[model samples]
Target: MTLKMSGFNIHIVFDLLAASLSLVGTYLAYTWRLRAANAMALGKLSTGYGIALVTGAAVGGYGLGSANLILSEIPMVGRSIVGALAGATLAIEIYKRFRGIVGSTGVIFVIGFTTTVAVGRIGCLLSGLEDQTHGIPTGASWGWDFGDGILRHPVQLYESTAMAVFLVGAVIALAVRSPFFLKNGFYLMVGFYAAQRFIWEFLKPYTSIAGPLNLFHFVCLSLIAYAIYMILRSKDART
Candidate 1:
């Protein structure tokens, strides 16, 4: 048997290819409108893809850190939250000065965030078994087995399914002719995805603090809270 290793990851052989695909996949979704809103406007697709690229890297850095595979050549704080805010603010200022367009909120969060999660999770799968994960064992054929005869749940599949459903719903809202759907569509997407993730996290094994307060689940709770807030705010805005 041959051992493959690159700083703690097994699939380091094709790692770069996976990341390249993620970036390109996000880029294509972003730029699919095929036309700009106006002459001076930056294409919505470009702006959305740009945001997804930045955010994707930020999340990837987290995975790298978890893997303990830090590369010294790369800037330590690059793609971080503070860095993103600073970079985006500066970019927006320059765009404003030069009469270039900024992406809309709907584009940034819905398309960008969903694409980021979809692409970013691939890294998690590549990283494999390191990041938090858990699932039931099935005697049925077709499931991932890892770590010396340990049968594990395919948590990533659960998340990917959630993202796919949300993406389809988002496309429908954006493309179909329906005012009611368009008006609250974004908030609805957030709420549904957040709720699904929150519930699914329970299936994974996690430490409990005072009962059901693990790290992953805790983050899910935050998303749930934000989803609720987004729904309420959207309703108020509509009224």
Candidate 2:
């Protein structure tokens, strides 16, 4: 579909808002009556994001660029962050309601974050990156010419496939309602994604902000730590 509505191309905003509203609504329904649906977590996630956005905008504005940059070149950042919070919140609530024992409460946050990245990055691809240096260079017969033969990997599709796999695994795992998933699902998917994103980073072109704390390596390390923490905590909780 064309990525324009009227003249303003706010695909990222709409996607984030739509996905968050839809998923949160689904979750509320799943809980039956849409009551006590982690209003606090929702507020906290929004507040956290607001803080990040404001801080980032301030930095950008200081650098002579508008704060809009933080909200640009991204797909569903606001929406997915909220969704992640919702997922994590619902996870703990679900665990309490069904299992009658507390499990790693934050696991769903990781899962939601990963899956949303995978699913929503397509929006980025659709809108196209404004930065010239962001993907693989190509000269083959089948290479796409995004105006400069910057034959980049379809990292979006790659991630989407991985995420679809992760989503299926998550649903199946949840259907079983096994405590193991409640503890380990977040880490497993995140750990796998860390490696995948790390490799994809090489194929990806570097950005002006591509420093030691760039996207690929950063996501990898963070997820690995989260995975390890969840598993370790789950084990400890059992004991």
**Best by lDDT, which number?**
2
- lDDT for model 2, please: 0.49
Residue 186 displacement in candidate 1 (angstroms): 4.4
User: For every model in order, what is the number of clashing pairs?
Assistant: 1, 2
Q: Pick out the ten consecutive residues of candidate 2 with the lowest summed lDDT.
A: 60-69
lDDT of each: 0.48, 0.49
lDDT tens readout by residue for model 2, 1-239: 12323212544664585478447634633354212433333333344444543444344223322211332354321222222332333334444455443443334344445556655665545555552223565555444444443565665556667766776776666666655765566567656666666666666654324553343355356656766776787688778
Q: All candidates: CA RMSD in angstroms?
A: 7.7, 8.5
TM-score of each candidate structure, all chains considered together: 0.57, 0.57
lDDT of 1 by residue, 1-239 (tens): 11122423533433455456546644554455312322133233355446654554456445433332223233333222212322343344344445543322333245555555555554444445543343556454545564435566566666766787787777665555345444444456555665676676566554444476444444445545655665576667757
Deviation from truth (RMSD, Å), model 2:
8.5
